[model samples]
Target: MKRLIFFLVLLPSLIFSQTNFEKGEKLFRDGKYEQAQPILENYLKENPSNLKAIEYLGDIAGHDKSWDKAIGYYRKLKQMKPSEANYYYKYGGSLGMKAKEVNKFRALGMIGEVKESFEKAITLNPKHIEAHWALVMLYLQIPSIIGGSESKALKHSNELYKLSPVDGYLSKGQIEEYFKRYSSAEVQYKKAIAAGSTKKGSQMLTNLYINKMNQPEKAAKIKI
Candidate 1:
């Protein structure tokens, strides 16, 4: 009789907590972060160890560009679930964005941690496409003196190509475009369009023809 009374007393609170989480998660999935944030925060207070709530809160913070808050949440998640690849990826991404806003020297000091986090995510999940893309961009953007290398970028791009040919072509095109190799970029973009027939690929190729190559006629001829 005592145990039954205890269970009855706990059931209502548990149901209420679950209901709040469901409602918040629904809003989150619908991209209504503003509406979801407070509810999720409240739910998290009731269930501090709830991974989904923590992740949602972290994602909301990231969307708001509150990098420090996002980093704190993701760091806690990493501590809670060390083997989870996505937590490491999110942590690295938030850290990288924060690094960009700081002084160059401070940012430089953070580069290794950002690199290692993404690399760890990749190591944990080889088929993780986003991690590969992140590494490609990281290697491309940093100076050569600080471990940046076109060859390293291309290596990740090549890896992307193995996993996703369209992305591979697009990333390679982006690298060429970054280096002002308009013709090479054009070739890669064309390949991307052929591989995926995606609007993004079409737009990139059209933009290249118009902006870089100064060929408005070719840009106009591009078929979506």
Candidate 2:
């Protein structure tokens, strides 16, 4: 009778906690993050070890551009679940965004860890397309002096190609364009269009023809 009484006393609180989490999760899924945050935060306070709650909070912080908060949460997630490829990816991405807002020296200092995190994700999941794409952009955007290399970018782009041919061609085209090799970019972009007929590929090709190649007619001729 005492045990039954104890469970009954606990039941209402448990049910309330569950309802709060469900409500918050529903809001999150519905894209109502502002409405979800406080409820999730309250639920997390009561159920501190909830992984999904932690991830949702991290994602909310990331969406709000609260890099420091996002980094803290994602780092915690990484520590708690080291095998999760996505936590490392999110951690690296947060660091990358934060890097962009700081001094050049500080940003440069962060490069190694950022690269390592993304690489770790790839290591954990070889066929991880987003990680491969992140590396591709990372290699292309950084200065050559700070470990950026066209060869390195191309290497990941090739990996993307093997996993996703359309992405492979599009990324390769982006690299060529970055180097002002418009003609090469054109070829790659055309290949991307041929592979997937993606609007992004079409737009890129059209932009290249119009803006870089100074051929408005060619741009207009291509259908989106």
Candidate 3:
């Protein structure tokens, strides 16, 4: 009888330890991050080779903005599965967020890390629009002195344009307007409008011509 009781007690613990992933997943889905973390962490401690567990823990840490923990989890996952593009990209994003909390020099390193991750993502899956756009935005935000390249930014922008012409045209127009290329901006904006942009397109066109191009009279003549 004592043996039976001992077996019963140990069975639950054994099951819990082995199938902790299901429990952790349920907790995460229910938004119980605090409860989920420990269970996931304990499971990962023993099964350091479990990519799925590592990925989930990284996701949880990221959602909570626990940058250090998230980076640690993602790095482990990346090391385990070096060929997985998404893993590296996710690690890069975590690093980028953590960088924002640090000095500029450190933040610059984070940006470089982000570029490498996104580049690898693109290499692994050229059709990844999110990674492509992220690279474009990152390059644009960096200053020339800090290794920013306008040409690289434009290249991504053009690729994005080819992938989604309407969105690409509008975004390119916005970039042109930023650089004071009013004529080019106007043409692209108009193209977006004709290509079935939302009402926001009309507003953008009106503002660009009136504010940037200094032609309110012409902007007023444009019909929505």
Candidate 4:
């Protein structure tokens, strides 16, 4: 009788907590972060390892550009759910953003962490689009001495091409433009335009014609 009574008492509390969590999650889904944040935070005090709550908290912080707070939540979530590709992507993307705001020395320290997180994300889900985009930018922007490689950037771009052709061509175009390969960049940018990334492609092509190719008339008359 005593054990049965204990179970009966505990069941309602568990049910109530679940209902409460669902309510907060609904608010989160509806984009009411401020209203959802406190409720979720309160529930997480008791269920500190709840993945849903942790992910929501990370998203809230990230939306506000609170990088440190967001990173903390994502770091905890990734630790709890290592196989989740989105967690690694968000964590690495946040690290990349945070690197820009810190001193050059601190930024240098974050580079490896940023790269590793993106790599893990890609490894977990090779078709992850944002992870490929992140890798493309990272490889193109960073110096070769510190692991940057246009070849690697192109590799990811080709991989993206298989998943999303416009993105792939745009990425390759951007990388070529970065290396001042004007003709090649123009070719890929034109491909991107044909593939429906028209606005950005137009801007890039115009910039190339006027700024790099020194064809101002061509830039002015350019159309996507």
Poorest stretch of ten by lDDT in candidate 4: 215-224
TM-scores of the candidates in the order shown:
0.95, 0.92, 0.69, 0.82
lDDT of all predictions = 0.95, 0.94, 0.82, 0.92
Task: Put down candidate 2 lDDT per residue, 1-224, tens digits, no spaces.
Answer: 99999999999999999999999999999999999999999999999889899999999999999999999999999999999999899999999999999999999999999999999999999888989989999999999998999999999999999999999999999999989999999999999999985698999999999889999999988889
Report the C-alpha lDDT of model 1 over 1-224, residue by residue, as the tens digit: 99999999999999999999999999999999999999999999999999999999999999999999999999999999999999999999999999999999999999999999999999999888999999999999998999999999999999999999999999999899989999999999999988985698999999999888899999998888
What's the C-alpha lDDT at position 77 in model 2?
90
Candidate 2: where are CA atoms >4 Å away?
Answer: 221-224
Query: What TM-score quantifies how close candidate 1 is to the native fold?
Result: 0.95
Q: Residue-wise lDDT of candidate 3 within 1-224, one digit each (tens)?
A: 99999999899877877788889878988989889989988898877788988888889999999999999988888888888878877887888789878999888777877788888878887767777777776777777876677687788888878888776777777677767888998888888888888565678889997788788898887777
- Which 10 consecutive positions of candidate 1 have the poorest summed lDDT? 192-201
Between candidates 1 and 4, which one is better according to lDDT?
A: 1
Task: State the displacement of the C-alpha of residue 80, model 2, in Å, after optimal TM-score superposition.
Answer: 0.5
Tell me each candidate's RMSD, in Å, in order: 1.4, 1.8, 5.6, 3.3
**Residue 146 displacement (Å), model 4:** 1.3
TM-score of 4: 0.82
For model 3, the stretches where C-alpha displacement exceeds 4 angstroms are 1-15, 165-224
